[model samples]
Target: MVIPVLAIVFTLYFFSTILNSPWTAQVSAFSLGSLLLLFCVIFVAKTVYQLRRGDGTLSFGNIVSRDDLASGRVGLFLATLGFTLLIDYLGFTLTTFLFLLVSMTILARGRGFMRITLVSALMALGGWAVFILAFDTRFPRGWFETTMKAVLANG
Candidate 1:
């Protein structure tokens, strides 16, 4: 159920992007639609497999474990939503770093503040260097727009 739900969500999101893009007029919408449809198919296949394994009597409750609900995984989903809101403003590296740090500490129960700090910093720097710096990727930057423009321009 979770996998199918995520697939549907991601499919909608990708479809949205294709719709919003300036090249939508030039590109074939069918291609994008078909690709997303593939995910839907995969979701159905997995769901059917689960149903068969359950002797045609599937329980939705069993899919998501009680321990998962009790843990801070629910909060992680909320954090993912929040991270998406912040991504445009903070840029991918900073936003991903912050999200990962919060997720690891809260949900994963990772110890050692120093380790988290180090890991987050390294991940942000590496992501920035590789994606934004080396590859010259152009991710949206709401607040850091000017700074990103300058750095990317220099590169």
Candidate 2:
């Protein structure tokens, strides 16, 4: 309730601040903001409905349990936080690959390597190709991708 309300308020403020931006930037920001707003609206409505039906309380009673904080949850949360901070080093494609692989591995206790590999490859390459082909925006290629490109170009 509170979080979504804040998100909705901040999103509107952000949209106001970006109204003068060019279409390319505005389109991306507008789309993302609209999506976020839509989700927030849905969440708010659901929360209200639950409250009316006496299904759940607004209180976040023990939501962040100590056991969860002490468990692998913390590791998972830290991994996600670090992934965002270090993504530019590996670029979107490779960073996404490693993030999905390691996150899924941790969640599933090391099972589903084949599934994870397939999904991660599809996401990374598909994202790269989409940006390169569609948007004409080749994202930051890390050292590994840069080297491969140079090698391929010379060969």
Candidate 3:
């Protein structure tokens, strides 16, 4: 019920933005897609909670009490969004590596720092190498591109 309302509102908002703003259709589509995905998750979570409770209503006590809990994923998501913006300014290889490292660190609880670091680095480096070398795809040239170009010039 609430999810449907929010979804309608978000759709209207996006439609208005597309009509009024100078942003390209792709950008508006992406924004609307994200909003729709968020609503889907919200709907799913609510449904799951209701099913788990065996009641359609979540208790007021549960909502008032558990609202204080800080979900760590919120911070991780904000970091990822920032990293995405950084990609336009810092390039894909560097941003992807840094974003993956930070997100993995945050999500890896009770894990050894050394192990996490090694795994994150290996994954990030291997992904970038494959995309750049094998696929021959061009990524954004961010702030680090000049330095990368210099290094690759020598290689």
Candidate 4:
């Protein structure tokens, strides 16, 4: 319920921020945000209905338990935080690769190191190819992107 409320608030705020942008820029944001807001509203309504019917209680007891801690949730959260913080400096591809590697390691309980590394590398490269190379998005450029651009331009 709390998550849905927060999502609703944030989606509205996101919509507000994009109002002054061009329609092209606003199109994707508006579409995605509207869907998020709709789902959040539905969730909130369902939770409220359940509460009114005496099927639920407004308790935070189950929100964060020992099981959640043991399940690597904290580690995954930290990895995400690190991705955001380092993206500007490390650039999209490298930061995404590192984030995925760390997150997969945490979720896999440190097993399958080779497979995780390969998948992370492949995913990072795929993202670079699609979003950076093909779409030419405004993501920050690091050594790999810079080198790739130079190689492509020369070749």
Backbone clash count, each prediction separately: 0, 0, 4, 0
Instruction: Assess candidate 3 and give its TM-score to the true structure.
Output: 0.56
The residue ranges of model 4 lying beyond 4 angstroms of the native Cα positions read: 1-60
What TM-score does candidate 2 get on C-alpha atoms? 0.50
Q: What would the per-residue lDDT of candidate 2 be over residues 17-87, giving only the tens digit for each residue?
A: 89998887688889999999999999989988999999988764455566665455766787798789877
Score each candidate by Cα lDDT. 0.73, 0.79, 0.69, 0.91
Instruction: List candidate 3 segments past 4 Å from native.
Output: 10-71, 143-145
Clashing pairs in 3: 89-143, 90-142, 90-143, 91-142
Candidate 1 structure quality by residue, lDDT tens digits, 1-155: 56666867776677776665677552676576677678788878877997888846556666567766668777788889989998987878778888888876776566776788788878877887787667877865444446776877899
TM-score to native of every candidate shown:
0.53, 0.50, 0.56, 0.62
Residue 113's lDDT in candidate 4: 98
lDDT of 3 by residue, 29-113 (tens): 8676777867777887787888898877544554334333254465577778989788887777778778877777766643577
The predictions' CA RMSDs to the true structure, in order, are: 8.6, 8.6, 8.7, 7.6
Top candidate by lDDT:
4
Give one digit per residue, the lDDT tens place, for model 4 in 1-155.
Answer: 77888888888888888899999989999999989988888888898899999998997668776776689988898898999899988889999999999999999999999999999999999999999999999998888899889999999
lDDT-based ranking, best first?
4, 2, 1, 3
- Model 2 residue runs over 4 Å out of place are 1-61, 66-73, 151-155
